[model samples]
Target: MSTTEDLTKDLSRIMQLAASDPHDIGPLLNYGLDWMLRLAPFDLVAVFLLESDHLVVKAARGPLADARVLRHAISLDNFTSIREALATCGPRLFYEEDHAHGEGDPFDGVLDFPHGHACMVIPLCFGGNAQGIITFDRERCGTYDSQTIQLVEIYAQVLAMAIHQAAQSQLLHQLMRESNERERILREEHQAGDLLSPLQSKNPAVRELGERARQVAPTPTPVLIHGETGTGKEGIAAFIHQWSERRRQPMVKLNCAAIPESLLESELFGVVKGAFTGAVKDRPGRFRMANGGTLFLDEIGELPLPLQAKLLRVIQEGTFEPVGSDRTIKVDVRILAATNVNLQEAIGERRFREDLYYRLNVFPVQLPPLRQRLEDLGPLCDSLLGRLGRRLGKPPLLLSENTLARLRQYSWPGNIRELGNLLERAAILARGSVLTPNLFDLSHSSDVKAGVGESPTPSADASAEAPMISLDEAQKRHIRMVLNRVNGKVYGPGGAAEILGLKPSTLQSRMKKLGLERKVHFEA
Candidate 1:
């Protein structure tokens, strides 16, 4: 028989072990129950809980019950005293004299089993909710003393708290797992949607060019863009600026050809107040305004040779004196120059400075004309038409197969800018939802409609068959057809460039080259 001293010492040892590792709750619970049973001399202890539809064995000692215990009804009749004790908020004790088994005791004839026994049922409560019941039985012991029953009740309270904490932890883990999975799915969908956007380039050449531009955008190199006019040169320059280290700063643009040679110097290097007849207040030049940013000079080839020297000095040394001012201003700027004219040819003719050309040509990117990449027309047209429809506040429009086919065959000399303008005009003028062929007119056509027979044979029939229209007359008729198709709105929407498959800039240049301006007058 264990004395009280031994029980106290054993309890102290178990408490020390439990305190050593609070993290290992499973082992701590089982070890605690085992130590308590050895010291307190209990025959069996059963820990069961009604969870969902099954009665689960949570913790146990001795041959009390198997882990796969079946679920049982919990009515007042089956466990009268147990239910009564739960309502009374105390443990229930059945004395050996009062105990009775109603025809269901499997171990009745076993060595340590007895039909009549003493047992106590303690209700497990956590946060005011009844979780389960704990039972301790003794075959020979008459009944548990009050002190022993009180100790058993204290153990049940601690065990219930641990079980409740474990359940909450499991729920939190499940919620975190589900949240992580949802975030991963959202990221995947976002990436897939990005891949389907119109700006996602599939053309190898364009893709490579875009990648290269991105790589160079962070640098402060002087980028020289070579492409025909109306190819969105300024847009590319703006993109480079936006992606560069100086994105937060301003990007100043100067049209080298638009400002006259006499005023170009003052325009670039600002004049002091009252220095010139039109000068009212002191103003900053392009270079000064673009300090710590970018300066995009379009039509760089048109800069006069005299002003080129001053521009070159500023670009090379970052020091320039404003016109009519002796004070020199130093600026940190990224120079991006664009031109449609051949600079090398201009330099050979002494029209452009060779040294300045080399300075600006440090990083050159040649944009391919739209005619070279005809495959991108479909997506480009779709995007342009969608934007145009939105801007015009009209129903969505679709280009007919014949119209698209004709567009693909036409040489788009003006590139994307021309295409956008064409769509805008077509959206406004289109009578129905479809852009038909009659809304578009092709320029630079060969004489396919003219009869290709040999010279007329001498006869009345031959004279009647001979065409009276001369080549010049045919050329005038073609020009009129092109103009009529564009609705006479030149330079922007519904322009000659849309009909001629040329950029507006390109059309203007071609009109100059072909002397079309002499025959056709442009209304302001």
Candidate 2:
């Protein structure tokens, strides 16, 4: 085709493509470059944009220089000609090659393009602001025709419009993505935020544990969660998935011990239609359902020995066969296994596979019991109280000083989960705003009440009753009292940190400063 016809055809196509898929700039720029080469006598085309800290290669079509790596950034203050060109043209075309020694020019001393024989520069503009530049270079000598130059300028204007619209679309897309991410995070926080606090503990070990949990949330590494039964292992697993790359995907859960041994395989790996007498239809397994997401195997230690081998095979190969089916289906999933039972012991007993243990234990996060974080008790109470109060729709409840003091003296056999349950119950029963000593359920705090009743005795109670107690003695006594109430539990919902109205992390820090034991407990 002739130059005019070719330019006409290319420009038409660029406009069509931009109108059809206005969100994409790649297609529009590529079309422009193809025609700009054919209509003109240029062998190379490059597009560049000055980003915040560096220059970016927007588009390039040639075999000359390493244009990808030739992302040269010039300071706006230092390179005045380039800056002026941007300020003036902003999407205009320039044919100047040796602009360094030009009269009345801002660039007094600069290197001209010696290797680059001749150049045609086009500024990319949007909304009166210069966005970038598109340059076409030729190796041999030739002056562009007036008609050809006019045509190129017209095409450049169209190209600039396409670039601007594409950029606006991309900016909108990015804003939407960020907004979705923020909303998702806020929802997850609303769902799980009431369960833990950062200021509830001052112990280093507890703080370290919380930090580990936070750090592991964004990773796909298989997490092995270890803790007592009421320690909120499932909560940790959910936290990890909520903050991970696979947050949008499903979080499948199965209690290994809850399902019967005979049905466990079908439950985990799914079953084909008519596989067994009760099999009704082709079914997707938990692993398949949790594809591109997380699968939480609660009480992993209870998985039958025979099923353990199958589980191991699936974990290793990402493929599993349905019950009575030979065909293996593949899936992508992150495993999060929680067990109150000691996995090492289970492995020693030949109940759990060693290979599976290692696979799930890629990142092990152990939850501390409630008694360990006395400082967290207070905040945990506030959180739980708020939730329960909202659920019950009553006046805001307050945990009385005496009630909290009494709570600090008991050993919580059930960890954070237990504490949440206990507080929820207490909050419901509390007639007034205060959670008094009558609401306490544990047996360990009997002595705290007993000691409170006796008027005068020559025991620790006598010394504690004195009004002129030293600050050192008072702090130590206070610490001892809170520890006694919680029975030394720390690092979870409703632990000592919750009762104490502090973050488990903050309490942990204070404990380190005080040189407290790793296992902090309350003793009346």
Candidate 1 runs further than 4 Å off:
1-199, 386-401, 431-434, 443-524
- Candidate 2 local Cα displacement, residue 281, angstroms: 4.0
Report the lDDT tens digits of candidate 1 across residue range 348-458. 999999999999998887766665455677776776677667668888879866566546654565678877777777777778888865565444444112222212222
* CA displacement after TM-score superposition, residue 265 of candidate 1 (Å): 2.2
lDDT of 2 by residue, 71-118 (tens): 444455654556666778732233344433332212122223443255
Name the top TM-score candidate: 2
What is the lDDT of every predicted structure here? 0.65, 0.67
Best by lDDT: 2
TM-score of each: 0.46, 0.50
Candidate 2 residue runs with Cα over 4 Å from true position:
1-190, 197-202, 390-396, 444-524
CA lDDT of 523 in candidate 1? Answer: 31
TM-score of 1: 0.46
